[model samples]
Target: MLTVIMASRNGAGWLKETLDAFAALHPPEGGWKLVVVDNGSTDRTSAVVRGFQQRLPLTALHQARPGKNAALNLALEEAEGDLVVFTDDDVLPDPDWLLQLRQAAADFPDTGVFGGRIDPCWPRPPARWITDLVPLGLVYSLTVEREDGPCDPQWIWGPNMMVRSALLEGGHRFDEEVGPDGTMAYRMGSETTFTKELAAQGARCRHVARARVRHMIRPFQMKRSWILGRAFRAGRGYWEPEPERVAILGVPRHILREVGEAAGRWAVARLRGNARERFRAAWDLNFWRGVLHEAWINRARPKRRADASRPGARDRTALSAGPD
Candidate 1:
């Protein structure tokens, strides 16, 4: 049996579409179990899940403590399937998602973790340059066609990943301190840590292109402020362990470089067409904002050596020092 776990927070708008996609993936012999973890959504997210409960074999778990990891852990505790699949509420899986995953796992019995592609479902048509400027998770659509073999482990994107239950029971789970939680501190990297730990434990992890999902890219994300904010936060998460002197000097240095590059592009675009340049400027600015916000928060609450020994210390440090 396959258990699909989705950790959601105020994702009412897109929950139905995701659930519908899952329902479409149901096997004719025996359908998969769907578990939705409602992470303290103020909107009608719970109600939306309730509507789908009758049509599908769904279970809703409520985690009042806010955080994507917290909600994921809650679902993990209750997951009863031999295989566990994780995805986000905003992502719509392909019709053959489960079928492809099952086939991939069967082909490689030793595989512990398998991830698919995620293409952005942009609200409006975006300039081609925007794809280059912003990271669109992994380019699974293009990479999936290669021959099946062991590849170097890259960072994991949350939208589309599947892991076996034995892997979690053997003591691997999502890091609870980070991930998007309504603040500028959008925490990430838990997926990266989880996959690395799986590899370290001698478990095989692979990626199959057949299993794919369309990530709904919101209009708000296209804005210049949001793009820069995301970029800065990502930078802060990457470089959190350095001394204050290093961080203080490094923050503006990177931001200035990005700003200069964006300005140069914008200047060239003035003579040519401005569409690509404008989008690049927007992404760069937003990324810088996220980085600066992360730096400011880090400066405000410097991490003590004692705090570094906690359960989620690395992630906490990353969230505090930078964007996720």
Candidate 2:
């Protein structure tokens, strides 16, 4: 059997559409089930899930916790499938999404991770500014457009990725510090966190372009402030750069070069009145700022342990120092 899991918080707005899509899906060879984890939602999220229980093999779980990873980790207790699929409530998946994922799993049984394509579905007409950031894969969770076949597990997006049950069963869990938490400050990279750790343990990943989903781009995400904020957070998720412990002439060469490049880009973009270029420069600048802040934060604090899956040991406030 296969189990599809998702963590939602106040997602009733578009969840009905997603649930309806799941209802219409034709089960694969071994049959499939749905597990919905309500992550501290005040809306009618539970009601929506309960309503769909009659139509789909649904299981509703309530994780009073605030984070997406927390809800997903809670759902692991109820998961009963050899292949576990993960998605989000706002996503509108194709009818054959499960079929394609199952087929890919069958074809690549040894591969530990499977990532599907995520195409954007704008709620309203997107402005030029919003569309411009799509190619960067920074505004949202869209992965490599031209990428397919075997690729790095880091390329996997959370909205449509699957992993072997054995990985989760082996006590590997998503990093609680990262991922959505129904907050404006939510840091991305929950899926990537677990996938990378699994990859280090000799696991491989595959990209299944055939399994596709339409990622909903809400109106809020189009705002300049929101987009820029996401870009900044994404920088923090990209990697936590270490502080320059050694400096020549009391200055770090890399920091100086990065600052100079950022200033140059910002100046050129402003002079040319290029919105895209302006935001691109801002994104890089913010990323470096995040790295600097993280380095300072880490430097001021003592080193912590590395085990992320231990019960009651996960740091609720610690953020994932993204990919290096």
Candidate 3:
């Protein structure tokens, strides 16, 4: 059986729609079960899950701890399937989503990570400022447009992806330091953290293009400030300090210089009265600023440990220097 997991927090309205889509799903060959973890919701989120109990093979869990990773960790205790699929509470999946993911796993028996296609259902057509400045994949968790086959596991984001149960059961857990925590600002890319570690252990990854879902893009995300804030958070998530790079107080010296330069660019863009250039410059400024701050915060943890999965995998920068 494939056990699908979701974490919800005060998103009852959206969850209702997502569950309705779930109700229409075509069950996979091994059958499927749904587990919705209530991540400290004040709304009727629990009631919503209960409403779907009779419609799907559903299990409801409550994790009062705020973060999304924490809630997912709680649900891991109930995982009992070949694949532990992860998704958000604000998505409408295709009818054959489970069947498609199951087929991908069956077709690629060795691949431990599977990514599904995520299309955005925007609230409305976005303005040019957004279209020109914001990236769908960065903020919205949309995957490669329509490509299939082998791809980088990092591209497989949290909105829709599946992993083999053995890894989690083997004691792998999500890093609570990262991922959503019901805050105005937080790091993204929880699943990518786990998947990369599993990949380091020599587990192959794949893109299951047929398994698709439409991630609902709320109106709040359209605001420039929110997008800029996300850019900073994205950089924070992307941070991986090169051990050999010169540093002081854990932050690379080069980063300080780059941030200063970005500030100069930001000033110049503002002077030029170019909306696009100003936004681009501001985006880079925010990204580098985030990287600089994270670098300083991770100062003591200078380098990553060698990949323990293989005898001699190449050393590379890691997302969270903290343990999984």
Error of 3 at 194 (Å): 0.8
Q: For residue 12, what is the lDDT in candidate 3?
A: 89
Once superposed on the true structure, which residue ranges of model 3 sit more than 4 Å away at CA? 300-324
In order, what lDDT does every prediction score?
0.65, 0.73, 0.79
Runs in model 1 deviating more than 4 A are 28-31, 138-149, 243-324
Candidate 1 local lDDT, 228-262, one digit each (tens): 56555554444343353444443535545655676
Give the TM-score (vs. native) of candidate 2.
Answer: 0.85
- Cα deviation at 225, candidate 2, in Å, is 1.2
**Native RMSD of candidate 2 (Å):** 5.3
Backbone atom clashes (below 3 Å) for every candidate:
18, 0, 1
TM-score of each: 0.77, 0.85, 0.91
Off by over 4 Å in 2: 133-136, 241-244, 247-274, 302-324
- Looking at model 3, residue 91 earns an lDDT score of 88
- lDDT by residue (33-150, candidate 3, tens digit) is 8889999999999999999989989989999989889998988888887899988899899999999999999899988898899888889998987766666677677774858888
Cα lDDT of model 1 overall? 0.65
lDDT of 2: 0.73
Candidate 2 weakest lDDT stretch, 10 residues: 315-324
Q: Is candidate 1 or candidate 2 better by TM-score?
A: 2
Q: In candidate 3, which residue pairs get closer than 3 Å at backbone N, Cα or C atoms, i.e. clash?
A: 250-299
* Model 2: per-residue Cα lDDT over 18-83, one tens digit each: 999888887888999899999999999899888998899988999998998999899888888789
